[model samples]
Structure formats: structure tokens, C-alpha cells
Target: MNEKRMLDDQHFEQMIEEESICTTDNKVYEAPLDALYDTAMHYCPGCGHGVVHRILAEVIEEMGIIKDIIGVAPVGCSVLAYNYLNIDMSEAAHGRASAAATGIKRVLPEKYVFSYQGDGDLAAIGTGETIHTCNRGENILILFINNGIYGMTGGQMAPTTLPGMKSTTSPFGRDVETMGAPLKITDLVAQLPGTAYVTRQSVHKPGNVRKTKKAIQKALEYQKNGDGGTCFVEVVSNCPSNWKMTPVQSNKWMEENMLPFYPLGDLKKPNGKEK
Candidate 1:
């Protein structure tokens, strides 16, 4: 596995070099493959994972820490993240991404570590690991993608699913009376003394995309400084296929519904501020 990883790295690096474009002004622009592999992604049409992956790769490249970063991905839509990200990656059992990331960071204190998880994996089955990891101040970043429903598992309801949100498991829409209100895991963790940064963001708009990237960049920087106990970023995204809406419709629905419940902005900041 190690040998294969090295070979893959070398191959992708070579591809980047070969694809470099030089302008007449003597400036060279390299292809966006420094931290992301060149292969096509497996996410569904209009999925947010592809956009998020690109920004992550850009950040790793900008920070020049491609070799020093490790990512942990658990079961769900992002389970194949290792295949997309060029950096070293580990696959954990469902909802165990935080635990796996904690171990990796502990073993390699010098390296930057993060976990990429979806709503179901992070807010549902993995809730225990996620909360405990944050409370323990694990010194790692947790990238939470909350689409409100299980995108890869037949559109089942998730812990983050909002009231009146329809899913395969909640055909009549989520009922707070019996199903309980949607979990604002980001807000829940922000109150923990162990968490140094907590924010909710999205990528449905160009401006929001920039904010999300900045949030991720800041989270990683906090980890680099080794001051923040835990940095949690929640990206409220859309699930077009599972929601039975066109890519355009999902984004519209998300704006009208998801954004109102899981508002975008920082819930906690390292500078001792909350919004």
C-alpha cells in the first residue's frame, strides 16, 4: 500500500508538471492537482463534495503542506475520499472518523490531521466519537458536511434533517413531536471548552464558497499553531439526487430551508467570540 501510494504521488506530480501552462508574461500556472488526484470523482451530479474537495486541495497547495497533512474519512458519501485527495488518507468505520483522526494526530504530533465526514456519519452514528473527540480537545480539524439527509444511503433521514424535511425514512417530513428537532452539532460543540473554532458554512453561492474556503483555511492554520484544541467546520450542503430535485432546485430549496435553520457564520472563534 505504501509503495502504491508513493507511485500514485509521483504519477500525479508528473502530470501536474506536464500540464503546467506558461503565459507570455513569464508566469506559469500549474494545474489544480497538487493536493487532489486527477481522476474523476464518484460524487453525484451537482454534489457539493467535488467543490469542497477542490478548495481543500487549493488550501493544502497554498499552505505548501501537502506532504505534512493526513486525512481520515469514514463511511458515507466521502468514504472514497482517499481516492480523491492526494495526501495520505485513512478509512475508518462508520462514525469513527474522529476517533481515527485523533489517533493519527496523537501518533504524529508534527503533522496536520483532519476528518472529512457527512451528516449521517458525523451527527448520527458517530455522535459519540465526534462529541468526545471535541471535548477531549484532540487538536485536529473536523470537516462536517451536513446535507440534512443521507445522500449515499438511499436518502434516509439524518440527525441534521430539519422539521418538515422529507426523506426516505421521513416520508411525511420530519416531525419534531416524535423525531426530535434537528441537531445543531456545530453549536453543540461550540460550547465545549475543548473546541477552539466552530463555524457553519455552505457552497451554494460563489460568495459562500469563498467564505467556506476561508473557514477551512483558518481551521487548518489553527491546527498548525497548535493552540486550538479542536476546530469544527460545518458546511450545510445540498443533496440533489436524494432530495429528488434538480441540481438547481436543491440549491434553491437549501437557501429557502437549510440556511434558515443552520445559518452560515461562525458560532465560535479562537479569539473568544461567538455568533
Candidate 2:
């Protein structure tokens, strides 16, 4: 009995010493959930949607604009964004996120407004609405997620799909001649006089992810300050399931194929600087 007590005392002392070494100030990272709900995300493994969403929520929280923000998510993989973000999020018809955001922002000019859309919704169906919104120089943020293919609605070829890329509709490959060349919508928008900031980024690498987060933050800040007509941020992401490759393989393929077509960097900036 005495021997057991001595061992227990030694163990207790060791635990106490360890706890003393690990102080609250020593903590490096903690998941941000002030603006996000504590629930499992519906995105596939290695999907960049979750990462973008996290950084967006973090930015909103850090800026102290949770209640002063309104988001529009149209029909796509991100249609259910309201289920995760604990903020005022509204649903829009297919490819009408920008229009809806315009209405909302016009009605409530004091609030921070943004639209979250996917490539299929933005580049194809919502192209007209998107172009007009930017042309009007609406004080809103347009978040475009480009995965090269149509996700959530059968891996079909999207407007942003690269040449020679295979999809459900284009089994042979995306032929630029027959299917029309891949749309450089970001570059196209940058040419418009109303766009204040236009940048293309990716989330497959840690460095790129950090840069994307920073870009998103700058976009919102620009909107708040009325620095430009419109803020457009395109996050070139990967679709592992739709691409029919593992998460690792899809990222590698994106790095090699997608990056070349839709290179990362600022296409336009509010200060007249561009790449």
C-alpha cells in the first residue's frame, strides 16, 4: 500500500509539472468558430471550399462585422453555406447570386454584402449578371470558386475547364475549337472600369492559402471603405471527386494543369497596379 502511494505521488507531481509548462500563452493555434457553426462540413476530403469558408468567417469575426454582414449563396455546392456560417445568408436562384447581392446591398447600404459562387454558376449561367454587376461598380464583394469542372451537378465541363481536360460531358477532352476556349473571366472582368480589385489565387498550398485569406480580407476592407466599384476574388480550387482522383492526385494535377491556364496573381488592383 505504501509503495503504491509513493508511485501515485510521483505521477501526480509529474503531471503538475507538465501542466505548468503548457500555459495558455504557449498555445499556438485555436480553431475559429465565433462566426462559424461547430458542425461537420459537407465538402469532400481536401476540398478548398472549407478552407475558404474558414478564412472568411475568421475575417468577419476579426473585423467585428458578423452582424453587419449579409451573404448570398446561389445554387451550387456552396448553396448550403448558410447551414455552416452563423450570419445573415440568403439563397439565390441558379447563377443569380450577384443580382441578389446587388439588391440586398442596395437596400441595406450600411451592411457588408458578398456573394459566394462556384465556377459553373458564375462563369456560365451567371455570366451576364456578373458582368453587369461589376460594370455598375456595385459596392460588394464577389467570391468566385473555380474548380475547372462543374461540381455537385455531375462532373460536367464548365466554362473554366482547361483544354484537354476530361469531364462527364467531354470524355474525349475539352477541345478548344469545338467547345470554345476556356473563359478567362477574371481577366475579362479586370478590363472593366468598375472593378476595384481583381485577383486569382489558389488554396492547394499553405502559402497560397495564406495569400488567399489575405486577399479576401483586403476585398472586404475595400468594400467597406468604398475604395472601388467592385471587388472580385477568384479562388482556383480543386475538385477531388469530380476529377476522379485522390485528394493528393487532384492537387498535383491542378498545380500542373489548372495553374497554367488560370495563373495566380492580381489581374487588377484599386491603385492601378496590375499583373
Candidate 3:
């Protein structure tokens, strides 16, 4: 017991020493660490998940809703969103994130609830739940991450896969004639009467990161103010590993290829204008 206590004390002292050294710098622009736990992330090095998570944390902290927000996560690349975000979270079945988020928001109307889902989860399997949730105006936020390919599973083609985009299942490039045109889920949800603020934004760079953070803030604001609608924020991200390219190359490819098919901006809103 004596030896164990001494060792524990030594480890604790070492941790404090390391923290003191790291925190000594008076660096400007250091983001607040209130809403994200200090831990290793499982996402790829250049995965936009980290940036998106940081923006969410910034918004939650700025709005003073860190304790009043709940997140619902579905399967796919973001299955572990709850692990990084310091908030009350509930796991949902694959493609059922929207339904689960609706239930949680309904039960606790005062709390801000949001769902973090990937393209495959939202645009394919969860299509019905997503449509219904938006149609009913569940007063929740849907953070849709569309990377065109299934990242969690093998790099399979998704409903949002662009024309001529190659994936594991689409080695010959997506044949739009038979595979069907990409489903613009963001626009589809915006046409629903229950949607309040619907916008497509990216966070590949600092400028876009700021814009995305504001978009998130606005969506939460609408829900908090009893807007009686759904807020859908689509984040066009890249899948470096699945896309078979370096992180930098993948981002560049996304800018050239993905942006043309799915142009960014407000697709739809309650007032027919971005707020």
C-alpha cells in the first residue's frame, strides 16, 4: 500500500508538471475546452469531424447551453460523437438518429437536441425517419455530414454519391442512368413545411469554419426560441482514406468535384431566405 501510494503520487505530480508547462503560454485564439473532453479522437487525421466538433463546442460555450443540450448519435463514422462531446448523449440504432432525436427533444422540450449523422445513415437507410422528422418540425437540429461515400463501412457508394464517382461498389464510376441521380437530401428537407433553417456549409478552412459555427448557433437559436420547425445543417466533408487520396488531395478533389454537384448555401428555410 505504501509503495502504491508513492507511485500514484509521483504519477499525479508528473501530470501536473506537464499541464503546467503546456498551459504556461499566453497564446491568443485558444479555443475554450469546456464542451469537448480532452481525449484521443478516432477519426482520420484530416477528417472534418474534429473541426465540426470544435465548432459545436464553441457554439455551445458561447450560447451558454453546454448543460442544456443533448446529442443523439447514429452508426457510421460519427458513432462515437458522444465520446468527444461533453454532453448528455443517447445512442441510436443505425439510421434512426432522427427518430431518436425527435423523441428526446419532445420529452425535454426545454433542452436543445441535435442528431449527428453521416450520408449513408441519413440519405439512405434513415430516409423515412429523416423525412418524417423534418415534416413534423421536431424542433431539433440535424447535423448531416455528407462525404458521398460510406466511411465507417467499406467505401461503398451512397445515395449522395455523385455521378461518375468511384467507390468500392462503383469501381466503374456511379452510372447515374441506373444508380439514379444523387439525392439532394438537404434540399428535399427544406421543401418540407416543418423545416425552419436549412443550409449547406463546409468547414475545410478557417473562414468556412467560422461560418459553420454561426450556422450551428443560429439553428440552435431557432429551436430554443420555439420556432416550431427543424433545422438541417449539411456539412460537405471529405473522406480521405475511403477516397484513396491524401488528406490534402482529398480536400482539393472535394472542392473541384463535390462542390459542383452539391453547391453550398441556403437550400431552403421557413422564410425562403437565410437568416
Candidate 3 residues 1-275, lDDT tens each? 89776787779888878766545365556555889888888999899998998889889988999889999988999999989999899989999999999999889999999999999999999999999999998999999999999998979999999999999999999999989989999989888888989999998878888888888999999888875599999999999999999989998999999988888887765555644
- TM-score list, all predictions: 0.89, 0.91, 0.89
Candidate 1 lDDT by residue in tens digits, 1-275: 88776687778778778965554476564436779899999999999998898898888999999999999987999899989999999999999999999999999999999999999999999999999999999999999999999988889999999998899999999999999999999999999988999999999998998899999999999999988789999999999999999999999999999999988899999855676
Task: Indicate whether candidate 2 or candidate 3 has the larger lDDT.
Answer: 2
- Regions more than 4 Å wrong, model 3: 1-26, 270-275
Q: lDDT tens string, model 2, 1-275?
A: 89776787779889879767566788775557788999999999998899999989988998999999999997988889999888999999999999999999999998999999999899999999999999999999999999988989979999999998999999999999899999989999999988999999998998998899899999999999997879999999999999999999999999999998899999999965676
